[model samples]
Target: MSISRLSSALVASLLLFGAACGDDTVGTSPNNMTTPPGVDVPIPMGSKLQHTGQCAGQVNCQVDVTFNSSAPLQVRVIDGNGAPVVGAAVRYELSVGLAVGTSLNAASAQTNSDGVAQVEIRAGQATGAAEVIVSLPGDTSVAPIKFVAGVQPKDSASYSVTFEHAGTASLRDIKVFLYKAEDSCDAIREDIARERDDDASTNPVLTAEYTANGVASVDGTLPLVVFPGLSNGQSFNVAAQAMSRDDGEVELAFGCTDSNPPIENGNSVNVIVRLEDHLPRLKGSFDVTHTFSITDAICDPQPNGGYAGVLPSGVCLAIDLIGRLATDPASFILGEGSGDTGIIGLIVDFLPDDGILGTLKGAIESFLGNSLIQNLGRDALNEFFATWIENNAPDWVKGGIDITADIYESLQEFRVNGIIRIEREPDPTLDTETNTVVGLLNADQDGNRPGKQVWEDIIVYWTGDCASSAPAACRERTFSATDLGATSSVVEGSFTGTVVPLTGEGETGFGLIINEHTLALNYGVLILGIIEQVVLPSIFGPTVTSLEAALNELLLLVLPGGTTGCQGFADFMVDNIGSSVETIARNLCESLLESASDGIREFLTENLTISGEDNFLLATPTGTPCKLVEPEAYTGAWIGKPLPYIDGLGTDSMLCEWDVKIRISQDTIIETDGTFSGNRTGF
Candidate 1:
């Protein structure tokens, strides 16, 4: 063999044998110590390294900066094909927003022999994340690190709201709602739409229900809100609503969401609205100083003689007349929103609870020019007429009519032929004291509106022969009201004596003694009082228990529960004997029963448990205190506690709660709000 050939062959054989013995692949492999087949080693841009920490439960990761460099820089670590190379360079440049140290010129120490390195972060360094690059000569082992520093735990806030009128207000249709403030933060961006749904739709929306006593209410905790991209100055608004089935008196307030609904909650403010309003029932704006006309058939200047200037001391009827004037239906509805009114000479329907009008008695004794015949004094009757005008007439109606005292007539035609309709106004100002309409009636302007009185007196004088000489002057004042003021027409009845001019001009001139107008008042109320004062036991044959409930409600306002007031109220009801009072008591009894049922239901549903999912994770330079970060680079891991769950329960599990449901019905209807009486028909 040749010497040269022998040496070359021996060297080639040795090289091949050494490669086969090591088991190290030439190309990159997952566990390969050298560069992998396809992966390239990264190059470093700077000398400092920065990083932040995060866990699986996080929706966001902190980008806190640890070490910083003044000039453009980079960070890197050495790695083979699959793992971190022990000697690669990683660096980055820092800006004010990304500054972790006072000086950007700071740098981190080089890696150890195995390629591990950590930079020292300065104290009082601003928090933020800085982008870093990994530089390597044709070897890309380390990926770019999403570096961050300075993590903090945040605090949260919660709210709650309730209503003031949830229990005993006259008008009880009110709704209240709350909303979480929308913000500009990326993590909570979708919360805005979710909040709207939570407040308006599938709401944990609190609500009030109607009971016989009407004591149900709404209240609860409100969730927190965050803005998308916002850093400061966050707030919210709350809205309130008033509702009604029939128009009932209701009041509202705006402030903060609280038990009172009047006080303010930290984040929520209130806006109140009234659904029903009932006030100012009666109205009068004009001066009523004028004297009303006094109608009398005996005032004729004929055979019977009486002195002038002084009206007889007899009770009399003031000759005043009016029509059903309708200018504003919203304010005045004769037979509509009003209660029962006695016959006003019109085809008006009466409501079930309305009162009747006064009775019509003798008009002759009133204007007979003798005080002896009048049941009420003539001065009293006259005063009543004027006072009614002053108190009940509108400001415009005072100057409408023209008349004199010489007209001799009877005010009966209106009643005989239904020309006037009288309906009672609604009494919303129920006296918590008397429980009557006395004070409320004073505020009623609906029954009688402005511009109603057109004529001073509705005289129906006798439509007899003008040339007749018969001696029947007593039956003379009888005629249709339409015939008045017809020029040159035959007079309904002849005025016998001399004519006189009345001074001061307030329906006072003498021509002929004629027509008069008459109206009915609500005397039934007085009659009831009389009956109650007179025969007590007969009217309330049932025991006091039948009427106790009504008296109890009244006492509730004036008297407190379980006190002397309550006892006095109970005794008062037992002592009283009136059918009307008994009826009121019956209604109150039903209400009490309803209230008792509601209290039971409230006790049954005291607390509840809810279930929800919280799943999230963070991706970054893989530095985590939870020990989830892997030793190698370019992968993900977990460093958090396991998700919270019900003890001994599986992943797909629910809380089982046991409660005794107190129901108003034999069985209840289960709804999202809770249970309701299944038989609403009975309710």
Candidate 2:
């Protein structure tokens, strides 16, 4: 037998057994009561009444109780005479609107001595208004009581969008997506509607049915959005994109907004979206160059009689010996040319541990030591020593041994300081003409747009020490030779130029010509030493004093000082000799700057390779109504402009004026293979 039938049989058997037991209530049994057989006790009219408290709720639609809180629904009954109706059967029922989709918890309660009854009514997951009913069993005079409440869904955002393609062309079956501002629309959509393989197609917070029809002729059409209920003030990103029969994939438009402003408690917002011609971005490389000329003067010091008392006084130097030894300032161009050793490759990426000085510190010493000696050949040096003895030695003391010479160059310390700034701006005049849009530059006409820009916040930093050999004591000095270590080098600078506003034009639209940007080495000094060895007789023998002033001048020009060899001198060239040590140092720094430019260029190229295939929709201010619509193929070429910022939704911003181009090749078909004459179109 079925469980139900067996339970009924058991209940009936128990009832029969109870009836067989006589006077179970003892002296108070109804059978022992001696009363008139036909008479019946009637409840007073005023005592029959109703009383109740708000019914609490759980998993059902809202009523007097809070949903999921498990609060109890209550009811009370009384007789017509105002006395409590004890032992009365009370029933509680729940009902929901059919369209709203919710259910009620069924429960029954018995009135106690106080005529009170209650049941816990649960709320359903679905949201909508619902009613709870309470009534007594077979009551002729009492009416039922209905307690009503409204259920609310979880938090979400709703949006209504209207789409148009290339002016008045209406688009059908376009897919719309809403997602968290920080998430990807495609990823979110996949999670919401997984494919048959159970793999997510895309992840989206919410999605709507494909648009069946769109009336492009009208300005504002009925909404094509159906979103779940959202809490007030919630934010979301909205994207509407689709692929065309001709175009591969196109981004119509996207925006971000708070649910409160555009979405009312019971109303929807109307968003207008327009599709535009997309341009393919090109991938290629280019070069940068900077040239400069530097010149300075060198001063010579007067000789001291005490240091060279026996020197011949006949030779008079016209200009300072140091100036005479100096070479004319030369012109130098620095940039990235071909490879590491190339002229432009002087600048290189250095880690915190490696610096320019770390590699070139030896170069400084070589330039100071061997440069002048190599220029003055051995013959010239031999004649100079012979002349020194012939011209200055007293006539009575004539005699000179071959003056053995050993030249050594030493560098105790040096420092170099450098700064570089680069920037790019859009052309404000070109806008929406010739299929181009401009005026996205930093401007404030009505003040709604922010004047800040991308480059304004850019901070270029150099973090390594340029001079690792610098003395520890000198390293702390700011802008000094020892201070050549890396520091914050970005300068507050601006660029004024024009980019062709990316208008599907494959030609380079952005061009910036940075002329000789001055990279000044403001402070710091190089300590160079030229140590020479020679022997002189102790008493009346030929002394350094016996040398002619010309030889003395030569020595003074090359060495730091005649008396104190420890003195330091600056390698400033006032004229051009055959070779110049100053020129070499200057060239090294220039090459360093050029290498830096190469690095900066590479940084920009790697960071800014934006393409139409990315399908990113940048925000842009709606310009004046589009007056012309042209359908053309976009050829991917070097536009030479930085990729515009995309997904500017909730940010309340848009892309600067620019053009994007995309090209789709049409297929050719012939009735006969290659020789066919009949016209056919396809690929």
Candidate 3:
């Protein structure tokens, strides 16, 4: 009678087959069964539930689904006899929650041969919980099962990072910058460019500083990078950099937002980056040091050349006179190859060769013959000597003689003191600048014209007796000279020149030339006395002095082949001795110039370096940085002493001493004390 029960005819059929009915089927068991009442029979289907995909975790009674996401809901249909109902129909229904917008594809579907029917449950864009039910169409014996699903905001996340090096974790006082995916253009471009051997340029989106060692934090003080509005499956790139305090070098890190715990759909993610340094760093300063020596090749007082006493040849008398007269004070010794040695070494070493003295002698002779001594012509000189011979009454003197004899000597003490300063121009070009450094020799800063007066405060002291006690040639002590005072004197003029950089291919070079300059000697007391008293009377004595007249007449008794009168002897001695001192002073100036320009070049070329972390020079790929610092200014001072400059190799060689100080600044030199001194032995 009840529609839910199986019919008697069906029961008769079941009895004939000895089948049984059970409650495991879609509805209650059939009304009739051939088996015993307690017997349980097979059932092809049950009221149990199951699901696939996003809805798999849903309760069997109430399957849930996500918004805008699709999933399958299935149920099996069978007969009370536990056999599948080939064409049975199943009903489906959806119950959407209050904030959800979604629905099922169909409310009903026919069961397949396996007694199963599936309906796809699709969700809407809105987020909220939803439910689905599955059951037999008209049979109320079995309860419908329900499944639930939910749609929430998409997954999104964020990250924080720190840097480290050589196991040291602290990254103090370094700058950090973060760039978004779009803003990471600089990082990507640089990466590609570096691959092609090109230079890289940087660009950043946001920046922050790290004060803690090794740690860059993203907290309340520093906000973490957030991707707040990303939907499912979307992502972006990220780049960051940490830089040195001095801006000398940098380190970089890169990442992607698409990584797990992904930035998409309200999800959050965290990242950490460790950096390694590869770029070169910038430098601040560098330095170089040099030591120089002094030698007798240029400083020797003996014009005769080579060591004294070793050779049989005697010393030159003219050299001895000039050397002793040009004394360098003991307080300021200029050239000290060895500590406290003397200016004789300094002045002489800086001067030219003895051969140059010969040239100066010719020059002086020309000047005297044409100007100062013009009053005494050759014929007059002959007549004067002839008169002396007539009055003296010597048979050998009846014929006039040639008064030309070689007078060789060595100086007891030759002294010179001066200031050598180096300076650089304000605007120096690269390698091509001319006269960038202006050299002032003994420059005067206090006079009417500052930096214009040169060769100032020069001292040439001569205080020694000349002429041997024995009579080798003329009468003994007849033409003797003594006690040239030790008073100091200065040259009247100055020397100005320019220093040029002789830069060659990959090496440092130097050059210098005196542009507009002059060093004029203002012969003071000693020189004037020698010219007027000693020289004037020594060779032309018979004609000009009674003391020499008697001696000249007595010379014939000693031997033959000698000058009865002072014919040409005065000119010869004056020419050789007088001209020699001039050349010596000039040569000394040249030596000072060479020391400055050449010394600077050699020091830089051999010693400059750029990168290693110390006082010694460190080299870089570019070049040695020390070479880049140009000379700015210079200041110098010197004091002479009585200590003689003696050679370590020979006991006979000796000269005056000087203590000199030359302070040079690369930018500008200010003379706190404009002290200068000059000494000259002139005709």
Candidate 4:
């Protein structure tokens, strides 16, 4: 049999069931047929026509008539003397507006010996109200009898949605929407966007909102969601979002009923939707502000007036030797020399014997190390010092100098800034059954996907003479590694890592695992610049000049005869020796700065990298699960290991830490509703 015929037969069986269950008044017309006054016809006296059977008085009654079902209509005709009018014929006709295929089982039917005539009013696949007309054939005495029936789809059912949240946050409200089974999740998302935007024209098949009070369910059920015009075996999809507020911040979670079961006749299905932290809702860029301090105990003051901890032991030894030679020139001289009997010859001969040359050279070697001294060779350094003594020895003797006592009392400040971009993976690993996702993270300089990029700047301010009213007397300088210049600008770097879903203690969220990342800044060159431009000029220059003046004064007092000439000779030797020593120390210190900078960079990188799992609860305000507005701000702190000493010089080092604050905002707004006005405030 054809599908339409089979449907008709099934509907017919349902109608029979309705009749057997005493529901025959369903789909019945209210009033019976009556003869019109204008009709001119000859009728037998006392003859009457009326509706009979279980479907009587069912005219235009408000009731549902299942599609392809028939409504049985029975009528009786009697003669004038109240006797049965056997063999009388009755006709039936359906008015327009009824679906096509709505018809009578028989156009005409003869009355039986009991004076009864019957016909069936069948419905069609569409929904609308139509009247069925009954009349005696070829007789104008009785006007047409009308019976109304409303056609509707079969197997239509309502749905009761139940929301579930595993987190501790109190749910404020849940919005649910239904779509056709063939519609993709993206399409449903677009519809949701329309609703969120308050678009009046866009409508879903079914929508419901449930308000909660510290719970997602009320009496284990919410409002029933009904979709009209649904037939048996037709499926649909359900999309819902639950919203909660905590500490003045809004949080949103999503759930979907994918591959929903088909509708069954007269069934009220219960659908359970569990909310979770989906990646798409959390995708965006965040601006982070961090403040951290790097302190070295070696820089701190000691009980002794001398800074024994500030400079390396080797450097301290070389400085002390030079100081002794300045205060007592007679003791430094070993013996007289042949080619040049002047103070310069005596000093040169005294250097190798007193082991001052070896001591200074050893200090320089220790300061620079092998890796840093590769370009500045030791042979070249010795040659330069020897050549300096033979030429331009008297110029350094005339200058007077003073060393700043509070040279080490200065403060160093570091400023850092960055953006953290979160995006969906091209091929994300997900478990639909558990609603879990394994998200990947990496440092892509191209600014794509989930990654972190940072920029940093360093500044130094001398605390000496801060009590002076003049600000210029208090020295300050900013250093940048990028161009090796004094500028207050940040240099860029990146961090590498991964974020994975975490579940424990009945709570779920994401955990950030940052790999050991090396900063892109050139710490060696940066430190080298600071040492050459600031340290050498401000501190070492004065120390060298002071030593030269002291040695000249000492020579005048110690020489036996011809004090004037001896003083001049002493001046030349001290001047040449002091200038040469200063130059060599500067060069060695420069190389040392480079080597130390490398170590500093390594230590800073290790301390800066976050250790262990930075576990954040999914439902908490600080967690990764969050709704992205046009602009969102978050505040937190990143604690790291204590700062380590250079060459293990100090007992304890201050912690290397950062107080992080972030502001997340979007520049481009994507409208899923197809109206790309670009003014959306939130997702």
Candidate 5:
């Protein structure tokens, strides 16, 4: 048998057993008692009735019962001393009206051995509140115990929505959705459509069709059930989308009810939704070129005339980036190119570990040829010894050589190129006061709040080339264009600004306001590659060779007499030179790496991303309403103007304004394929 049937049988059996052993007396038997017919016996003085079991005390006094369902009413008889008073007669009375057809299994019951009396109440066809009063028989002075039951309806609540549109297009069909008050309109639309596609039974709450032109109104009885977890008097929101077809192209207008309506049981609520023509979502390709320059000193001068004495004065690095932005599964394609010639900084500091000095000594020795004395003549060796004595004798003669070189290399130009795919959706809400609807660009397609956007398909390329004077090593180490490697860098950002309608000055359309944004780029691999492959070889290869050549010339001028002393001086100079190179390389690989990384990050954070009111406006001719046309295409000029804060692009007025031709179409599907086809221009 079913669980409900089994439960009913058990309750009936328990009631029968209780009745069999119950007492009919007014009071005072331990288990069972009998009273003579027509006898008027008063209940024991100070006796009272107390609700118990499922109806225990005040907390469990009320319960909800569905139609045709039953609930048990229980009570206990206790004396003033709080002890059980068995064999006492009890009376029960259920309220009327909504509880008219509700019946009790017993009108009167005597308390059992435990002084507990119980009765089952079965509800009828109506839905409302019902009360049951329990009192002792012939006890006029004692108060009665009360229990409450709320009768719930058997059917789901219904609603009706009326859609009214002010647009001139002839609507083919209008789809209506019912959502909770807190749900976003964009999420509701996507969720309901997904549910219906997954299951045919999950169709929208209401749909209406119309063939008339201009403004029109249509109403439909919504086949909607109150949302789960909602109760009577709770409110819900209504949203609608009206679609119109012209030739083979389709356009859509949206609307929503201004206020949420409460759910009423067994009744249909009427809601009026006002529709307005909104800007069709535009998907297209855009290109932006940014140029900036940075000039900074790498290392501060140190004490004792150490490595700082040989370091380059300062560095000036310039960068140029061409970025392409596209919508309909949003993406950014960045192409890096050569910048103006300037000094690029290459700073190196020695690490505490890793024996960097030894490595440098070996590398320098190999470059200079290990058997220096065998290769040079006696006269050249004498002159080399004399030059070394004059330059290094003061510091070296004092004690064991302890040399540290703080050197800096200047870079002419820097550039970067990459592509990043991102997701964005318009989350719109109605403005009651202005009677207009505005939307915010949500990165994650969520509610009205700011959402984190994870940029995908990020491919960055280092496009800077080595100078012509650079050695073969530097030239061979140039970055390759075809190697598209994946990076773990994820830029956490949000687009929280508003997209509002624009009208005035011979222009009518929409503008998206971008206000203050931050983008982080992981430069670990890129920076290391630049330093190791490009900067080191380009600067050190030429500088070290020139220094060695000068020393060899100076050595030729010395006399050939003191050959032994010359050899000793030559050995000292070679070791100290090797030590200095090693110190510089070690420092670059360790401390300077972190410092450069932080500097680049800070530069991007402060100057790359746009800040303040950067308006991107898509405008059509005045008096021409922006509307989707045949082929679902729109061709116009997009204007980007940054006002107030222009710190991003420095003081270059040319970087403040941009005008580009935008060719967009509504045919692009963002949820599926992210590919787009068109002629790319104006880079």
Candidate 6:
């Protein structure tokens, strides 16, 4: 046998039977599937109606039907008027090519305890129709049979808390403070460092305040949290208990809210804390732990460089060690050169709850491994220069510069009307003043600045009004530069004698006119520098390194601890250099648009889609698949759009997540026209 296979077996053996083996985890059960309700649909051959109808005449084929049931899904065949049909041999036919129906492939299930049966249709079957027709058993309403999956609890939490009093001894006033795991850390740190009860703090930081009287006198009930309060679809359910009234041995579940809190339902392990009064045994030998496993969902990355500059609440930090690590992780940016490392100034107080990092401040400084002080000052000032260098792309001209290339090229219209063949209709009768060499001046005597002079002013006239070409906010549209040279000592001209007024009715901002005048090129190096130095870095990787580090800290403080057997939880802590950022960015994007679609189709069909199929086009706020504001093309630079990112993925290819993930091809796309009109108070 191959080494890999042998290793896998050994690991499995070790894990399953406690026998010497390799590292692979043993597997006995597969992922769970929804159990359908008890049904008695007899299969004449198979339930696959695909090829069984009439398409199996001239070709070989197989059919497969996946029966998706909620739960406790079983079926029983019954005769008319409430009688069970016994030993009914049912046959079925199935087709394999299309989704309209599926092809069947094997033995059918027979009714057991709950009156249920299953059937499969195989390939190369006849075109004849076949089915197991059983009589109605009885009115299902009375007994009310159902195919319930037993899934709910989008708003509830389940947890068990145990408190152990001083073994055989007892004390009075056993108090347990249940602060929000959301802000536990900062609270812990602040409570530990500061000496006050009242303080004003900004930042509506997440936190919960719950207190249960002493469990000392031998008994007391531990409280379970259901909500932490912010409801912008935001949710959290984590616990933090105070350590033993004895030496930290009587561990209290607490949180350092700086890091992300344990996922809403991500605790796959249970936290079993047994209280002990013994000195050494309780101090070194006892292990406080928990076992928890969660649904595939809810396991998501935190948003916006979590806790970058936020002071974690003590309640946030008191959860578990992993939570600590999640809240506090080792992070660094690979620099390009000395001093070139971009700087990340502590914006301070990611979440300035009570401004009391003052208490928790030391803890945060200790936590960040940086030199920042909380409440009293800042907490952990780790200098992480941006490794995110900005690269310059072509200048992005604003101010309606995208006026269509065609329109622009055509704007070169230089009076291409009737040729210069003056039909003499140009007042051929009137006397025209030709520069008759009004004589080249004598540079020696008439030293009047020696420039060409037009001793007269000419006026050009036209009729009819022109179209308005200004956008709404163009009134205060003065020259966008330091100054406008319009009235400067530049060459001035007129249509009359020596000068000309740009007369006539025409588009106000239509075109430029100049004669014998020179134009200055605005290289706009300053603007270019701003785009490269400020725009790119700020937009793409701004303070990313430090923020990532801070996020790692937050994740450690919030996610579950090593008490849980899951690995890579730490890896999940730090946002590594590459795809790490991309993943966070994508998930954030998904989070942002969650309200728009909510992946309804994916939820409906347990399978992810390629740009979410056409049938799954997520609706916008108005319940439309991104209706155009004007029947125009989708031109908005949406984050991710269904675009041709991958080929050979078959037809029906659409851009998934807009332009981000392109490999998936299902011919469906989430489109956005970036066209938004909103009112803002500021300029």
Best by lDDT: 4
Positional deviation of residue 342's Cα in model 2 after best superposition, in angstroms: 36
Tens-digit per-residue lDDT, 1-683, candidate 2: 99999999887664443222122211111122133322323444554434332121211112322234333444556676566665566667665642144444446655554555545545556544455666665464565654444444533333444444432122223455555645554454344334212234433344443222221212222123334344555445555543333333332222222231444553434455444322212111111111111111111123442111111111111111111111110101111112101111212333122476545544533532453433332223334334433554434224321111100001112111222221223333434545333323342444322211111111111111313465544322222222221221221222222223232323222222121111111111010001000111111232332112222332333322342111111132212223454444344444334433344323322222222221111111233111111123323421221112111111112112212111111121111100000111110
TM per model?
Answer: 0.18, 0.21, 0.21, 0.38, 0.29, 0.14
- Residue 590 accuracy (lDDT) in model 2: 43
| lDDT, model 1 | 0.24
In each prediction, how many residue pairs overlap at the backbone (N, C-alpha, C within less than 3 A)? 87, 66, 83, 7, 12, 144
Off by over 4 Å in 5: 1-199, 204-211, 215-248, 256-274, 278-424, 431-435, 441-495, 502-511, 521-683
The candidates, ranked best first by lDDT, are: 4, 5, 3, 2, 1, 6
Model 6 CA lDDT for position 496? 10
- lDDT of candidate 1 over 1-683, digit per residue (tens): 79999999886664343222123212111122233333433444432222212211221212222233221122225333323343443343333333344333334333333343333233233433232322233333333333222211122111222233321112334434343333222222233224335245544323221111111112211111111111123333333433322222222211123221222222222222222222211222111111112222322322233322112211111111111111111111111112211111111111122332111111211122233322122222233234334553443334442222212222211111111111222233333452321112221344332111111222232322222355555223322223221111211111111111122223211111111221221111111111222111111222211112322222243322333443333333333432323322333233333432332112211111011111100111111111110112222221111111011100112111111111111222111111000000100
TM-score of 2: 0.21
Candidate 3, 152-180: lDDT as tens digits: 34352222322332111112233333334
Superior candidate under TM-score, 4 versus 5: 4
Model 2 poorest ten-residue lDDT run: 671-680
Per-residue alpha-carbon lDDT of candidate 6 for residues 240-330, written as tens digits (9 for 90 to 100): 3443333323332232223333434422112223332211000011011111111111112235322211112111111111121111112
Error of 3 at 502 (Å): 32
Between candidates 3 and 4, the TM-score winner: 4
Superposed Cα deviation of residue 7, candidate 6 (Å): 50
- Find the 10 residues in a row with the least total lDDT in model 5: 325-334
Clashes of 3: 83
